[model samples]
Target: MKKDQLYREDYFTCPIYFMDKPEWVKKLNKASDLYIKKAQKNNQPNIKERTKKFGNKGDHGMVHHSTSLINDPKFIDLQEWILATAYNLLDEQGFDLKGYQLFLTEMWVQEFSHLGGGHHTLHTHWNGHMSGFYFLKGSERTSCPVFEDPRPGRQMNLLPEKDKSKVSLATSQIHYKVKPGRLIFFNSYMPHLYTVDNGYEPFRFIHWNIQAIPKGVLNINKE
Candidate 1:
C-alpha cells in the first residue's frame, strides 16, 4: 500500500485586481485639483469624511461631485478606461458581462492630507457589486490600505503556517502598498480602510462603485 500526502486547497478566497495608467493619473490629478478649488470657493460640504482626521475639511470627499466630473472632458477618457478595465476583469473572473446591463452607481474622489494625521475607518460599500480605487497621487510615507478577513469567527482558532508565504498565513488582515497610477478593484462586501498617514503630502485617490442589472428585468418596453 502506498501512502498518500494530503494537499491543502484554498477556497472562498478574496479577489483583487490592480492596474496602472500613467496618463489617466495626470488627468485625474488636474481635474481633482480644479474641482477641489471650485468646491472650496462655492462652500460645498465634504460628505465623505467619517473619521474627521486633521486636515483642511474641504480636501476630503471632493469627488461627490462625480456626476459633473464624469461629464467634464477632463474625466471622460479616464472614466471610459475605468469601465473598460472593469469589464475585462469581470470577464476574466468568468462573468458573462454581455448577459447584464452594467451601471456605475457612484464615482467619487477622496483626498487625505497629512496635516497631522489622516485615515479612513474600516468599512464596506453598499448598494454595489464592486468597489475600486485609482491612486492619483501617493507617497512612500503614506500608509497602505488594509483588508480585514470577512469571516471573523473563523479567526478565533488560528493555526501556524507551514509555508512562509504571506497569503498562506492565517492572518486576519492584509495590507497593500500602492503608488501613483495604481488601480485596485475588489468585492463591495470586503471591509477595508486606509492606514494612518505618516507622510506630509496629501494622498489622493478616486473611488467608484459599480452595479449590474440583468437585461430586460425591469420590462419598461411593454409600457
Candidate 2:
C-alpha cells in the first residue's frame, strides 16, 4: 500500500471552534499561585529565569508535567467538567465522536509561571488525533495563541490597473488576544507559538492538553 496519510481526517488546516469560558476564572485564579509555586519547587528551578529560553529545546516549562496530577482530587474535579465542555463544543462543530470511534485517552494541566511563555511549537499526543489548550489565565496580552498562516509567498499585482489594490500575499502571524476562559482547538500539526514578554507580574496559566484516539487503537498501561 502507499504511505499512510501523515495526519488523521481531523488534521485541520484551520481551527474549527472557539468557546468563551467566563465561569472558570475564579477557580483558575484560586489555584494559580499554588500551582506555580508547587511546580517551581518540585522542578528545582526558578520559573522566571528557567523559562526564559522558552522557544529553544532547553525549554524548562516542559518539565512541570507529572502523572500524579491524575490522582489529585482538585485536578480530577476541574478536569472532568472542563473536558465535557470541550468535547461538547467539538461535537457541535460537526465532529461526530461516536461515528469516528474517537475518545479521550489522557488529560492534564500545564502550569506556566512568571515569564513562562512557550516558544513556537505544536502538540502531538502519543495516541491523540487532535489537541488544544484551555486558557486559564495570563493570556490577556497580545500573544496568547498565534496561528501560523500556511500560505506564505509574494503575489503579483496582476489586476492592479482596474482595481486599486496591491496583491502581494504573505503569511503573517495572527495574534490572538485571549480572555481568561477561552478555548482554542486545532489539529496537532498546526504550528503555533506562545509569546514571552517583559512584565512586572509573573505569567501564570493552566493549559489542558487533550488526547483523542480511535477505539481499540490504544490501551491503558498502569505503569
Candidate 3:
C-alpha cells in the first residue's frame, strides 16, 4: 500500500522588492553630490579635528548624512513613484488600506566614509510601514545591507543549519549586494543594517520610510 504524503504550509513570510533603474543613476547622483558636500562642509570643524586625531585618514570612519530630501525638487519624481508603489505593495500583501493614506514620513541620503569602517547597527524603523534604500554608488568591495530574522521565537530556538550558505528555513540572516541605481524595499519592522566598509569603492545611498496614516488622523492634505 502507498503511504499518504504530508503537507506543508508557509506562513508569516517576509517580502523584499528591488528595482534596477540605471537611467536615473547619473541624475540623482549629481543632485545628491551637492548635499553631500554641504553636509561635510557643515561638519568641517569636527571633521578637521577627527582628521587631526586620526592622522590624515581619508574619511575612513565617518558617514555623511544629508538633510531631508522630502522637499527637494530634484527627487520629486522618484518620490512620487516610490510612494505610489509602496501603497500598491501593501495592497498586494492583503492590507486593508481603504481608510488610510500612505505618506512619505522621512527621506535622506547618506554616504559612508571612503577608506572603510563605515557601518550601522541593526535596527528597525518602528514609525513606518515601509522602508527602502536607493543606492547611488556602491559595489562588491563596499559595504552592503544585512537583514536579521524578525521572529523572536525562531531566534530563541535556533538549530544548526545543514548548509548555512543556502537560503532555507533554517537561515536567520540575509545580505544584499548593491550597485548604483539599485533600489530595495521591505517592511519597516525588519531589522537591517550595513556591514563594515573596506573602502575599496564609493558607498552612497538614499534611505526613506513611508507610513500609512488613517484619514481621520490626518488633518491637512498632501501637496
Candidate 4:
C-alpha cells in the first residue's frame, strides 16, 4: 500500500503590520489636529473637494498634502521601523531588495468627524507601488477598511456552496476592524474603501505611499 500527501497553495496574499507604540500614536494625532487648526485658520482647501471625482463623502473631512511625517523627529523611530518592515515584506515575497532603496513618495493625514454617515468609495493609489494606513484613533465601532479582490474573471465562474463543512471560499472582499496603533499595508493596485463610521468618536488615520528604486538614481528637470 502507498500513501500520498496533499498540499494546498495560497497566492496573492496581502500583508498587514500592527504597531504598538502608544507615544507615537499620540504624537500623530496631535500633529494632525494642529495642522487642521492651522489650515482652517488660513482657509486651506479641503482635499475632499479635489477628490470629489473619487467618491469621498464624509461629514467633516480634511486632508493635508505632502506632510512628510517621516522626517519629523517625533516619528523618526516609527518611520525607520516602517521602512525595515517594507524591506522585509519584499524579501518575504521573493524580491531581493538588497541593492534597492525604499523611499516614501507621499505622506498625508485624513481626519474625519462622523456624526452619522461617512465613507470613502473604492479607489486605488495611482503611480504608487505600495500604500498603507496607520490608525491614530480608532475603536470597535469605527469604520473598517475593505479590500476587494484584484483578480480578473473571478465573477465569470460562480460556484455553489455545496460543502458547509469546509471554509467558505466565496468571499471576494475582506474588511479589517479599526484599532488604535494598528497599521495595514497592501499593494497600491488593490481597490479599497472606507466604510461608514458608526462610533461617536472621531476617526483619524495617516496614509502613506512608498516606492523602491535602484540606488543612486537621479532625475534632471527640463528647462
Candidate 5:
C-alpha cells in the first residue's frame, strides 16, 4: 500500500536559498557600511519621489547609486558570488540555461532608516529575465516579502471538498520574512511589496539587481 499524502505537487513561488559564506557575508556588510557613509555625505536626492515608480505605498528610506562592477573591487567580488550561487541553485533545480547571457546591471545601495517602511510594489527592471536581492544587514523588524495573487476567484470553481480543505487558500500568495544572508529569486514580472517594519529604531539594508540576457539576441557568445 502507498503511504498517505494530502498533495504531491510541491509548488513554490521561486527557487530561493541562503548562501553560507560567513567571510563573504561579513565583507559585504562592511562594504555596505562604507557606501552608506559616502551616501550620507553626498547630496542624495529625495528618494520618496525617485522610488515612486518602484513603489510608494509605505514609508521607506532608500539611497540609489549606479556603478559598474569593474570600477568597484568590493562589488566585483559580490557580483561573482551572486552569479555562482544563482547558477548552482538553477542547476540543482534542473533549469535549462543553455545559450543564455548573464549581465550584471543597475548596481545600487539602499538604506532603510527609522520608521522607513516600504510599500507593496515591484521592481520594473526593463527586459529583466531574472532578478533578486541579497540582504546585507537588517533588524528583526525587517519587512516581509509578499507574493502577488496569480489566480483570483479560481478557488470558487473547485469542488466543495476542495474548497473546504483550505489548501488553496494557503497556496494563494504568501509572505516571507527577510533575514540577513538570505537571497530570494523570482521572475521579473512577479508583483511584490514590503510590509511595515516594526522596530522603533533606524535600520539599514542593501540590495542590487541581476539581469539575464538570452544568447541569440546578443552579438557575443557565452563565455
Candidate 6:
C-alpha cells in the first residue's frame, strides 16, 4: 500500500504529433509557388534584386511570408483535416470543447531565402490555442524545426546531461528532422524555432494556428 501511494504520475506533459501525407505535397507546392513568388517580389522581370533581408544581405538571410490561405480553394482539403485533428486532439487531452468551435485563425506558407542564412528566433504562438506545420519542401541537408522544453521552472535548476544525443528529462530541446508533406502539431505555448539554413537545399513549409472560440463569439463558419 505504501509503495502504491509513492508511485509517480505524469502531469503537465507537452504533446507533439507528426505524420506523413505525401499525396498532398505536389499540388499544394504548386499552388503555393505563386504566393512565394509574390512575397519575394521575383515576378518582376526588370528587378535585378528581388527582396531585401536585414543587414543589407541582399535577401540572403531573410524569410518570405505569404498572405492567408484561409480563403484559398487549393488549401481547402488541408484545412478540413487540420480542423478535425485539432478538435480530436483537444478532446483527447481532456479539454471541454462542447461549447466551442475550432477556427483556423491563421494560415500561411513561408520559405527561406535561397541566398542562404535564413533563420527564426525562438517564439511561441500565444494568440491561438494550437499550432502546426506542414512541410512542402525539405531534406536532410536543409534546416529543421527545434522545439524547446515548455516548463521554465525545470530549466531554472537544470543538471548536466550525460549525453546530448540521447533524449532524457534533462534535455532542453529537440530537433525535428523534416521532409516534404510531414505535418507536425503541438501546443500553442510550446516554444519553437528553425535552425539557420545555408540555402544548399530548398526549405518551405505551411504554418497555421487554430483558436477555439466559444459558441456565437464570432460571426464566422466553424471548421
Question: How close to the true structure is residue 153 of candidate 3, measured as C-alpha lDDT?
Answer: 85
Task: Report the Cα lDDT for residue 210, model 1.
Answer: 78
lDDT of 1 by residue, 50-165 (tens): 33555444334322233245556776776777677777777777788786766677776666644535587899988777779888778677757899887767767766666534
Those runs of model 2 whose alpha carbons end farther than 4 Å from true positions after fitting are 1-13, 45-68, 85-96, 99-127, 139-143, 150-172, 217-223
Q: Of 3 and 4, which scores higher on TM-score?
A: 3
Task: Kindly report which residue stretches of model 3 are placed more than 4 angstroms away from their true locations once superposed.
Answer: 1-4, 51-58, 220-223
TM-score of 5: 0.65
> Candidate 4: what lDDT?
0.69
Best by lDDT: 3
Candidate 2 backbone collisions, by pair: none
Q: Which runs in model 4 stand beyond 4 Å of their true positions?
A: 1-7, 39-70, 156-167, 219-223
Off by over 4 Å in 1: 38-68, 156-165, 218-223
lDDT per model, in order?
0.70, 0.53, 0.91, 0.69, 0.56, 0.89
List the lowest-lDDT window of 10 residues for candidate 2.
154-163
lDDT measured at residue 148 in model 4 versus the true structure, 0 to 100: 74
Off by over 4 Å in 6: 2-6, 42-57, 219-223
lDDT of 4 at 190: 82
Model 6 error, position 10 (Å): 2.0
Which RMSD does model 3 reach against the true structure? 2.4
Q: List the residue pairs that clash in candidate 1.
A: none
Predicted candidate 3 versus true structure: per-residue lDDT over 86-183, tens digit per residue: 99999999999999999899999999887688899999999789999999999999999999999988899999899989999999999998999899
Q: Candidate 2: lDDT of 91?
A: 77
> What's the distance in Å from true for residue 177, model 3?
1.3
> What TM value does model 6 have?
0.89
Cα error, candidate 6, residue 187 (Å): 0.9
lDDT of 3 at 32: 98
TM-score for candidate 1: 0.78
Using TM-score as the measure, what is the rank order of every candidate, best first?
Answer: 3, 6, 1, 4, 5, 2
Model 6 per-residue lDDT tens digits across residues 125-186: 97788899999999988889999988888878788899999987678999999999899999
Estimate the lDDT of model 6. Answer: 0.89
TM-score of each: 0.78, 0.59, 0.93, 0.75, 0.65, 0.89
Model 2, 56-82: lDDT tens digits are: 333333434433344456656666765
